[model samples]
Target: MKIYFANGLFALADRMFNEVVVDKIRKMDSNIEVYLPQENGDINDKMNYADSIKIAQEDNKELLSSDLIVAILDGDTMDDGVASEIGLAYGKEIPIIGVYTDLRQHGVENPEKLKAVGSIGENPFAYINNYTIGLIKMNGIVVNNIDSMLAEIRKYL
Candidate 1:
């Protein structure tokens, strides 16, 4: 299976996902091919107009070609880039596997939620972005570890 590991480029999301999930998945199946955006994308430090275009093109190409997308929903909320990739996968009818480890609640834009999260580290009512979480649930399962992800993949494949 071809898998797209989507996450933020600037943050250490790539490295974290690589260490926690990608390595194990690769070792588990010889036939599986994983595409990591931070590692495989053509983004440069300068990030000229052409370079940005190239990067987006490369990422989108990989996303479209992949059979599954394992989006890292790290940080307090889902990263914007990862959300965009998820949208692409949804449009293409590609299965999405959300890897969210941050127990912190997201979408704190609401005043009540922000107040709740202020008292506690995370709001129990909202664990992540509502739409993103709902979307993932609709297409695929959201897992906290590689084991669940593997199980879902096995069942799906």
Candidate 2:
């Protein structure tokens, strides 16, 4: 399977996390081929310079050819590039497995947490853009952790 691993790659933490996740995914199956954007330093390396068109074109080419997209959706907001990629994948009928591991998304069943929603500035939940999430749900699914993401991918396999 060809997998496009999409996430924010600008920060050191983000880059390291991407590498670790991709490595785990690769270990899952020898036949899985993952296209990690960070690996394409020509376009992603901050020290180097690549034009916007070059970056978009290169990523689009890989995205179009991919069998699945593994999108990281854990952030204050979804990365703009990752959201755009999700849109394109949706339009092209590619399945996506979104990993959203925000701790704020937990404790939904806690009554105190639920009551907090009635108070101003006391909401205990994190919000992800419904439209972007809708696009994913229409063609795929959103998972809360890496294990769930991998399990979903296994279904595709």
- Which window of 10 residues has the lowest lDDT sum in candidate 1? 41-50
Question: Candidate 2 versus the native: TM-score?
Answer: 0.97
lDDT of each: 0.76, 0.94
Clashing pairs in 2: none
For residues 1-157, write the lDDT of model 1, one tens digit per residue.
8989887767465566565677777777788888877565246343533465787888899899999999888776667889999888888889999987654434546687767766746555535787887888888879876688788767745
**Model 1, TM vs. native:** 0.77
Residue range 1-157, candidate 2, lDDT tens digits: 9999999999999999999999999999999999999999889887989999999999999999999999999899989999999999999999998889999999899999999999998888999999999999999999999999989988877
TM-score of each: 0.77, 0.97
- Candidate with top lDDT is 2
